[model samples]
Target: MSADIEVVPSTNRKNAFRRRGLLAAAVAVAVLARVFMFDHQSLDYIAFIKRWYDFIAANGGFGALKHSFSDYNVPYLYLLAALTHTPIPVLAGVKIISVAFDLVLAFFVYRIVALRRPGGWLPPVAALVVLLLPTVATNSALWGQADAIYAAFSLGGIYFVLRRRPWLACVFFGLALAFKLQAVFVFPLLLVLALRKWLPWRALPVVPAVVLLLDVPALLAGAPLKQLLSIYVQQAGSYQALSLRAPSIYQFFPAGADAAVIRPIGVAVTGLVVLGLVAAVVLRRATLNPARIVLMATVSAILVPFLLPSMHERYFYLGEVLTVVAACYLPRRLWYVPVLVQGAVFPAYLDVLFPKGMGKGGQPGMIIGQAPPGGVATPPPGGGRGPVIMGGGPGTSMYEPTLEYRILAALMALAVISVLCTAWREFRRS
Candidate 1:
């Protein structure tokens, strides 16, 4: 088909085009990474960087790592301690860590997609699409958040589980939960797998063991065993709001909603939805295929964030990657899935970075707390204008992003339903 040569090139024009596209995507990632690398955008970088660095400087960095009370667990804190002593600007260093994982997350996503949708441009293109998602980019590079860290491991765990590597999958899941509690987004799916007999219950013990493994260093240090064990339990009590300003069903309630009542109400509703899903999985146990199970996991990832009692806007980050897996697996006509999922997430980032400065309770100066030797001696971060957005007026609060988030939440709910229906249909076909 070549105009200048009688014989075709060893690599056809189509193959050449695909290679060119992949190269272009790689270039785009590099340029974007550089842009994010230097942007100095978030308060999280300022606040946590100093707190962590000071923790290292306060006593011995190793002692700080052993004590473990940074709201995040040992795995992340250990890395922070190491970086604290490094010469790199703490903000840039952490953001770089986040950004680098963003690509690893992209790689795992590509592997998941390629496992099912092999050939042509789908895998690479899908990975680029994920890397470029506004929420994904903003959460790591701009907001300096670590959702991607958990997401990468969770996705890999799911992938490995499907590949029949149960112990590896368990370890990956444990790694995810160790990074962040939101990693529970995929926790329910593991439950579904255990019920489906894809994973043996005997192998399930590996999860807790791995979690203990992550905590071993802290325990070995003088860190109270009670503190290490109750880390998540106490974190759950830190915010009592029905929504904690999450983009979900709770957003439909009146702006002045009461947590005492609304919390129980939300739980009751979420419980019913989860029960419905679990029932569906049980009914389809015999027919369960990897794609269907993936769809179920995607459903749980979205549903937990959507229906749960005390979710934050970023809690649903798992859906972003899991849907990609499901899309490529079913290769279903569901392009809108990721679109709807991320709609609320990026807006919440804007809400925090408001020009007015984190809107109320937003304190001034670097924060060091839980009052350790290095603590600037400020009180422990007492949910003050906590980076965790508390309840707000509909459009009435000085920080008026609530109304925008409410509208987006409703649309995201619809998006959840649409994807579920599409995946359910595919499950039946499977």
Candidate 2:
């Protein structure tokens, strides 16, 4: 009897040690990811800090509250403006608030993953992947972008939807949308909930209602609704001079393609693609797994910007965050594709962050030369030649791949192929 008891105790001890080891490993991964991605001194973070400080100082305390609404519908600006009233430097306060949001997002990701896979390491592992994702880390921690905060609230809204808390979900979703319009991409998922009768159809109106409620403060501050409409119009009309080279129909065209021609075609094509994805989800609803549905919705969102004529690298934030969530739930092999795509964009970001020249015109290839760390030795504004314009002026341009651009394009192509194959297979099975 004594021997039997000893053996049982020994077995329990082994199990305990295994659990402890796994936990330690997870913590180590999280630590490494945080340190590598968010050192607080990174160039992206510093730039964001500077920008926030300048805005606050120029406007005077609470001044941003009045002016910020004109720029973006971001409700978080009010919170930041409030924080600026504190004795701490506005920039530092912004960073602290941002960091706090990051931690909260990480927690949500972990919790959601855990809910899906009890006692499995997938939750923590997913959180680690999210932390390590180059774009997410850079945007959230370094650039002080609100993508992380919005994504967290968005995911929380999804969680509430899953839990059958429709009202709460709508409120959170409203907040997420207020931060960034990209949050609308998840609307399809909510529709799924409504169709399935998991959420009351009546709850649907709450989303737009919440948005209007949040906008009331700005509306009262003499912020014309037309200004908000104009922002969307400007975004639609203007083309970004520089963008990550992702695989899209655009690649088929000659380099230096005219924005006038590209913009309309891009919009139409992207719209079709989004519609197709939505149809696929609706058609496969009977057989589709929750994970697959979420993944498809996310891929659709990511591809939309690429399909649109004028896309900035920052636009990828919406898709990248969702991809990270999808990766966590997906099989291991599927995860690597997004990981590769995420890494591919880093080179482009590096190019932008450490541009070859400053005073030079923002031309494409103009190598004004490198600037040293904190060195003002480079010619002051207007001294150097502008960015080198790649491709011949107007017609007769040949496309050449920069190492980073080529890699990014290739990775995006791979992602498209993988997703297509998976979707096709699932469709056939159904």
Candidate 3:
């Protein structure tokens, strides 16, 4: 009997070590992919560095605080500015900071996933898949974007809320909002905490209080209200065009349609669709897993911008991060799809954003075929091969179409459908 017990303990140790080894190998691959494969030339890094330097030089270090409110609401700007005094290269500093945040995000995922479903291979698998996602790796290490940081805070907030720590959750959620406007999309999920009666309804003010505390620095720095509002106004007014990536049912339409005509129509349709989904979930008595709620909110946020006319690829950052957060609670099989989609989309989007020369068998001139009116391509009156796609100009075979967009669209659709069905099923079961 003693020998048998000893053998069982020994086997457990070996299994633990094996799990650790797999995790270590996975992390190494993720890190190497980010550092060596994708960090070729980070445009976003360069932009942030230049913007940071300009902010510092123009307005003393503290003065740079104004830029945060007036331009991007990214709180990390101040953090990055604080690091400027260090001898480290700006790009290196940014990459280090982002990677650190990614690590925190990974930890948060582990905790959240483990909490939702205990003692399973699914949590670790989910965490590993999230860490390895091409987009997450590339965005954090290569582009040096702070999406990971905001995502960390968002996940932390969700975790705390799940643990019935409302105040801490509020603080973390506020910090997330300070990091990026995308955090607002998750704001509604806070009601879950209130619904659970984890905290008094009056305690809800703590969230805005924390947000104000973060913004106080800028306010005290003499940033004007007009300027502050301008940041939002600029985003709202600009980019009235449409793209295939839009999240709405409207994406089925051709691009370049008039915003006046499409905007209102799209808004009404999206509102109805959103309402319908919410009703379905609620009416079905779905199980209110905080992780799944976060996933839905994240998907909603991502789709909001996509469904809206005129969005950029970077807009998917919030959704990508939320997908990671959702992975913590998802079954292992479900986790791999998002990971693969994120990985595939990140580099492809970057390629389009910052192209190197044509790959092969590609001529220079624009491949102008007759696109219907309101399509992405604007055909001439003659209907024979429209004008060149102006941004890169003709001969930019690098701009040639690839399967990336189609793949992403398909995967995203699959994910949305799968999650919705799962939520409905779980709701019914509950």
| Best candidate (score: lDDT) | 1
lDDT per residue as tens, model 1, 1-430: 3654644564577687877677577847654764654566565555555566677768777687556546666777777777767898777777778888888898888887777777667788777778877777777877778888999998889889878899999999889888888888767778778888888888888888888898888777668877788778767776666665567887777766776887877778877878777777677654766677678788888878888877766787888777766777765466667777777666765665543432234532222222334544453343222443222222223322367778878877876897779767765664
User: Candidate 2 lDDT, tens digit per residue, 1-430?
Assistant: 9999999989988876887688668656654554444444434334333444556556864455445323345376566657766787554565556656666676777766776686555776677677666776666545555677777788778667656678998988888877777677677667666765666899988887887787676566555676644554443443343233444435445555565665667667777777676676566665545565556556665666556654555666656766766666666636766776576556555555455542223333322223345642222122211222332334211122345465576676676566557656655666
RMSD of every candidate to native, in Å, equals 4.8, 5.9, 7.7
Clashes of each: 0, 8, 8
Cα-based TM-score, every candidate: 0.86, 0.76, 0.77
User: What residue runs in model 2 are displaced by over 4 Å at the alpha carbon?
Assistant: 1-60, 68-70, 191-200, 220-222, 228-231, 238-252, 358-403
Pairs of residues clashing in candidate 2: 45-142, 360-386, 361-386, 361-387, 363-387, 365-388, 366-387, 366-388
lDDT by residue (tens digit), candidate 3, 149-180: 77888888877877878788888887887677
Residues forming the 10-long window of minimal summed lDDT in candidate 1: 390-399
- Output the better candidate (2/3) by TM-score: 3
Q: lDDT, candidate 2, residue 300? A: 60
C-alpha-based local distance difference test score of model 2: 0.59
Between candidates 1 and 2, the one scoring higher on TM-score is 1
Runs in model 1 deviating more than 4 A are: 1-9, 12-21, 24-34, 358-385, 388-401
lDDT of each: 0.71, 0.59, 0.60
